[model samples]
Target: MTTCGDGRLTCDEETIDTIRERVLSDVSARAPFDAVTGNEDRVSDGAVSGDARATKTDREVAVSVTSLSKRFGDGADAVTAVDDVSFDAETGSIVGLLGPNGAGKTTLIKSVLGMVLPDEGTVEIRGIDVYDRPREAYTHVDAMLEGARNDYWRLTVRENLRYFATISGVDPDSVRDRHDRLLAQLGLAEKADVPVRDLSRGMKQKVSLASVLAGGATVVFLDEPTLGLDIESSRTLQRELRRLVEEEDLTVILSSHDMDVVETVCDRVLIMSAGKIIADDTVDSLLRETGLHCVQITSTDLDAQIVSTLRGQFDTFSANAREAGYQIEVTTDSDGLYALLALLRTSDVTLGRVRTVEPDLEDVFVDLTAGDRTPGER
Candidate 1:
């Protein structure tokens, strides 16, 4: 007569602890502009906030795109990668791009970078048209498209930085002082003479970052800087990023899935689904706007009938039986939690450990992109 799965529901003590233990995070790269950032960002309670308190008074439009679109193949094989999308990225900020699989994040970023020409729409960087004026547009920009692969495996860390800077037209000699400083700041100074092939993946990633920053580009587009990085390494990268934006007067546009990077680093988030942007706002605002808070409870006598009653009374409710009792998770707004409390009081089940679960990037991501889909006749 037991249906609660024999007390097999294990508690998530991992997600239950400090922030560093949970590194993968969300998106909201609004001011803190593009992708990835450093520490020194203070997050509290159950919400994710902006990385910086910088105002708009000193900010300037860095990258602008109006009505962008892209598609792959044609007819039956056609896959609409990016729909008519448009948004502005501010100077000296990190913006995180998030989406489900097949989402047009990559296509949108590529079209903006001019790597993939948009069938329709235009992309502008620092007032230069990226599509029409590639040279003039690229002069103020640089990108680390393939993460660690962006470097030459045989080149020394310093050699890679100098070589990339020169190819990108940033005079290595003129920026030598700046280059050395960046290496030191990014914790790559000691590894400067080490061959790229000899460095760990995380070190290589940092090298890629130094190369990008060394160019003195105003805007940098990073696909996923935190990918394959460990907790400490990721934290290091995030810290260096914050320093770069603050000291270098740099602007970044990053796309990543790690919620820790997104929620902690990005100033605002742009969530794309299918081929369109579904949500755009600061992380704190987005979480608050979702209006959903969760509560976990254990009951001694919860049965199928009582579980159904609870589910009927709430939009987001789930219960599972265990040998000790019933484990229930109910997600609702403020008033709904109150209603739930009232319902529980009158029920025959003996409830225990009813506490609020802090809403984080994962919750916001699931709710916003729950049904992320394209609105075309398929």
Candidate 2:
């Protein structure tokens, strides 16, 4: 037993596991909802089973939120956190949620998870209303929040997996094979018996993720899943997540500040600002729709006069001194590009190299929310 920071006596891991088993058993006896089983069949020999695989052509809605609104405080002091937000996450896909600080992303996520009671709106999981049928609706759901600390420190990696599965109303034994697969995929197999506290921060993050999927949750929420990981470890987790989504019909709602991860992994992105979703579309579509293009030009003949002339003509023009030449970047459309080239020709500027700058998700995010000053829930 250990005394927690709050001065509460906490039972040992064995004792806690026992209590969890009893609670699950009692809940099963009451039959509020059928326990999930046969998850081992979802994967076989390190591959997704044919019967469990989901494709984009036949995807189903995994999560649906409509007109969700939440406000804090009351009267004059009241602040609306989520304002009539609505979206759907499809099965076998990763949806990225993004927002600047105080943009209501956190409030929207909490409301959907039933962690916060919204003043209005509806949340549904797997076609079941979350507020009206939470027990049934949550059977297909799991979440890993706060990154590495989401798992038990005292429990071993495998123990954490089994514990989460058991508490989620699944028989741990029934999914032992699936747990083994998760361990291997996440590179935790060798440390299966090591306590989570004994592992590195990145490894602990992986354990938290494995625990989320241990119970065969079809819809999962991951926040900064690669928070403490190195480049290779982050890539490994990203590949595993995509594989799970494509192979096992998993639906993921991923929230992260890493725009590269969001662009590479998520099939679609929802950007929130001022307590509402301001943008909803695929990364490619969003980029194209921004209607902005950047071009970089390197020239040896770009003197102060030429630079000032270009800057005066193009508001987005920026120039940097380089050993070989002056490198300048300017935002322009096709017509503007032609005009820029013609201006450089008239100035007799000798160009060294020119290339197009690709705009990423972060660029689009900033462009959209650049003018937003409305404060909202963080």
Q: Against the true structure, whose TM-score is highest?
A: 2
User: Over 4 Å off in model 1, which ranges?
Assistant: 1-56, 300-323, 326-348, 373-378
lDDT of 2 at 126: 75
Each model's TM-score? Answer: 0.75, 0.80
Q: Please, what is the whole-model Cα lDDT of each candidate in the order they appear?
A: 0.73, 0.83
Q: How does model 1 score by TM-score?
A: 0.75
Residues forming the 10-long window of minimal summed lDDT in candidate 1: 23-32
TM-score of 2: 0.80
* Global local distance difference test of model 1: 0.73
Clash count for each candidate, listed in order shown:
30, 0
* lDDT for residue 85 in candidate 2, whole number 0-100: 96
User: Which candidate leads in lDDT?
Assistant: 2
